[model samples]
Target: MTRRRLLGLAALVAALLVATAAVVTTRLVADRPAAPSAGPSTTPPASPTPAPTTASPTPPPGADLKGPLNLLLVGVDTRVSIPGWEPHADAVLLLHVPAGLDRAYLFSLPRDLVVDIPAYPKARYPGGRTKLTHAMSYGSRVPGDKANPSTAQGYELLRATVSRYTGLRIDAGAVITFGGFDKLVDTLGGVDLYVDQRVASRHRRPDGTMRTLSGGGYIGPQMVYEKGTRHLTGWQALDYARQRYTAGGDYTRQRHQQQLLRALARKIVDEGTARDPQRVEQVVAALGRTLVYAGGGRQLIDFAYALGGVPADRLTLVVLPGAGVSSGGAYRGEQLKPLGRDFLTALRGGRVDAFLTAHPSLRVKN
Candidate 1:
């Protein structure tokens, strides 16, 4: 799937993680199990319920979460209800919650960033250098079964690729589909976001239906998101986030994705949705229906308790500097600037706060 079509999925995983952590302490509970080994052949369970095993008891609400945790959040371009379709990572975000757990840093990795994908024997993929997004597609192939691809297997490979690139261990990860993302927004009664730029949807008409193709481009009255604060329904928000034709292109889209997530998280907390038992249940159920979670041996609920204290205001959005790479006059992919690499180095050393302080431009204004 093209990255443009599934851009909104990034916001879904981020919003879900924060929302789940914010409210799970109230009533969510499940048996904790031992952390699964990497590259397990078994498919991830459809729901977040951990396997029944006598491992460490689930942590209580407001428990102290370990510091310097890195989570890999990916938005895929597939539907949960459908099978036999290969999925690619449409949106890739890495969330870093400092040891204090008082705040979190979220950043996006351009889906088209150039990277070296390692060989995966499970899928018979002798990987090569390519766009980073292709790692998921290469790893998802079922060795003998061409009809169905394993998202879990694909996630493992993607995780490894990201870990290698960033030089950090992925403590946990989660995957959500585009369909699930729509449901999540609607479940919360939509979201209110500031339109940083006017964006015209390439896939949708003014009435929210798919745009028709003519002369190699969409033909219809475009759905336009005006520049201002507006309350948006699920479809509208998704369409807006999916647009990359704005001045900043994918970078603009990335900012919007982060804004959407913050808006969703703010709504959950500001509206008291997190504290309401019934509402929390509805949100949790919606997540259960949509999310494929891997907590690196930790339960989702544990993360909830650990990160419960992180409010929306404390979350910071970061944009890494990069430029387009081309070969033979053909667009190849993206490469990070030197400053971006330095930021990653700081992240590995737990000096992100200091680094951002020194280079204020890297921090996205709220």
Candidate 2:
């Protein structure tokens, strides 16, 4: 690419990156189509903090100098305005954070690729449980009379369950809802992602004519994305990242989220956006407000600093190998799958811990 073209592309990419973070809020086009939400309620915007221009945050004091730290990254699919919206998790990412600087590995968990919902309330289902995604759905929509909301509890269970299911000690967990997610996207400007396939949507509407996305066939967004670089607004990016109805399904969607998040990070850093105090403050505030961090935020920053050291090429992406299939459910039919051995084996054999050991300064135990 010519220098001019490259610069333009980079600028476009940077804008898209910022857009990804800021675009966390958009009215849900269709309520039924989305997976149940982990919680309802619009997350209040976090109060801004002064951005630090110095090197990234120092890890928490005495963080386990052990090997790689497992970060349970979760994506909640609910519309934020409705508190405790129980949407099935459309995406799950397990970030294998190395001790120091080396790039971390990202393991994508297919949402439909169901696994047992650990600690599901037996009283309600009688049978014990349904799809893993329903773990939140059941927690929320079960009626206040029958059961309490599962947003916080669901997150806790997911972390515990994933660790047990995968046999990796997760150091921390961070979850961002659809609204916060949109904001984060916008904060990053916008994200440039290659649509792997045409995303078709128009299933129905009150209009006599069959309705689709705002654009054309199937309606809303372009389902069949040309296989090349393209700028995606917050809505478009979310649609691309969240939509899993493609022929490839959850696997594709999971990878797409990881890619876009990573891309957003890269573009931001490359564009010097992270150095901007206002932008940094927005990010930290956003995280604090919409995101729930099971552990310390300072530690998470330190983890980011350590991850920032790695070359992108060395970064590995792994998915717990599995498939999705429709499972029987009571209120709404659910889709589910098993968390296979491959996921565990990948963590066990991936030298993740070993890599972390190689770096000393980054290790911190609390």
Candidate 3:
């Protein structure tokens, strides 16, 4: 029998930790963040998602977060002060890392996931209770209307909820706001992706027009399709990843994002192996700048080491056991419900551990 795993709650529950560094990368130099705006360079446009941070990545020995670990990546929809487009999470993922790992398996969790928000502070939220989407909003949504803070707070809320429910102790937390999302995709020279369906064509168009592109086309505000795999720019990647309507809504979009991550992981691994240390560093730095993380270095390294411990064949995205949509209950943006039992079962039995044992563990010094 598989024992349920506890979602790591406390570790990631703290507020955001901002890593403000005048970092340099392939696109932008250390001293100048706006430098890349001048012209094109050898590096891809390095715009990262502005993730409000909480913790620095952790590095340790004999700690728990090794060998087949599962992580939940929260994409917060923050209202950016920038001109057009209201902020909303393009997607959310319940990503899993292997014990003794290197990479991670990502599973998209719809923001509108209909589940019990058990840990919601009753004193704060007197409106009874709500769906899981609030978990993501907790960081920014300030009950009435004071002012939204950062994505870091949202991850903390989610971490708490997941821990209260699943009982998993995660290593860290991070958020990729809409602004950060656009930048990161742009920085990647745009991520190559494909959409399986038709979706709404505008970011904030009052006119309800929907255009369907094939598979290979430059993405922007409309659905562009070409065939097979094609190159995408930042805006295009965001549009592609943000397309939930084509795949019947959030589920399809989430899956598409997962696919993109797989491709991205492959590219990154290849870059690292090719000994393009400089290039890899550039990418990592860009990622660090944009991604608001609870922790860094060791946390990511441990997850990587644990993930690397498992075989590719066994690297599977463990679906948190449960239903997605509630029977007759539906909320505006809410998508599915987390399977309480299934989530715990996977964790306690260490489904990831079995995978780690199947392969081999990688040792790293913190």
Best by TM-score: 1
Per-residue alpha-carbon lDDT of candidate 2 for residues 307-353, written as tens digits (9 for 90 to 100): 33345445455544354354374332333233345335645667545
Predictions in order: lDDT: 0.75, 0.51, 0.45
TM-score of 3: 0.61
Model 1 lDDT per residue over 52-77, tens place: 78788554633655777788888788
For model 3, how does the per-residue alpha-carbon lDDT over 189-287 read when each residue is reduced to its tens digit? 555554444444444222223344447743445444544566666556556666655645555566666655544434433333213445535545555
* Candidate 2 TM-score, true structure as reference: 0.64
RMSD to the hidden true structure, all candidates? 11.0, 14.3, 13.9
Worst 10 residues of 1 by lDDT: 1-10
lDDT of 1: 0.75
* Count of clashing residue pairs in every prediction: 2, 70, 75
Q: Which of the two, 1 or 2, has more lDDT?
A: 1
Error of 3 at 124 (Å): 3.6
The Cα RMSD in angstroms, rounded to one decimal, for candidate 3 relative to the true structure is: 13.9
